[model samples]
Target: MEILSKNLQLLHFLDKEDMAGFWKLKMMILKITSHSWRNWISI
Candidate 1:
C-alpha cells in the first residue's frame, strides 16, 4: 500500500520532469538500501 503511493508520486514527478525531486528520491532509496545492508551485515 505504501509502495503504491510512492509509485504514484514517482509517476507524478516524472510527468512534471522534476529531476531534482527524482534525484532526491533516488538518493533516499539508495541511502535506505545501504543502511539496511549494513545492518544485515552487522547481524
Candidate 2:
C-alpha cells in the first residue's frame, strides 16, 4: 500500500511538470503564429 501511494504521488508530480511544458509550448506556438500573421499582413 505504501508503494502504491508513493507511485501515485510521483505520477501527480509528473503530471504537473507535463502541464507546465504544455503551456510553454502553447505560448511559443501562439507567438510564432502571431508573428507570421503580422508579416503576412505587412506584405
Candidate 3:
C-alpha cells in the first residue's frame, strides 16, 4: 500500500525521457518490494 503510493508519487514527479528519475523510481520500487518481503518473512 505504501509502496504503491510512493510509486504513484514517483510517476507523478517524473517526466517522460527523464532517465535519472526513472532509475530512481525503479530503485525505490525494488527497495520497497524487498522491504515488504522481508517484513512478511519476519512476521
The residue pairs in collision within model 2 are none
Q: What is the lDDT of candidate 3?
A: 0.90
Q: What is the C-alpha lDDT of each candidate?
A: 0.87, 0.91, 0.90
RMSD over all Cα atoms, model 3: 7.7
Candidate 1 deviant stretches above 4 angstroms:
1-17
lDDT string, candidate 3, 1-43, tens digits: 9999999898888677796777889999999999999999999
Please write out the lDDT profile of model 2 over residues 1-43, one tens digit for every residue.
9999998887677877797897999999999999999999999
* RMSD to true structure for each model, in Å: 5.2, 8.4, 7.7
Please, what is the TM-score per model? 0.61, 0.67, 0.58
**Candidate 1 lDDT tens digits, 1-43:** 9999998887776754577777889999999999999999999
Misplaced by over 4 Å in model 2 are: 1-14
Q: Provide the lowest-lDDT 10-residue window in model 3.
A: 13-22
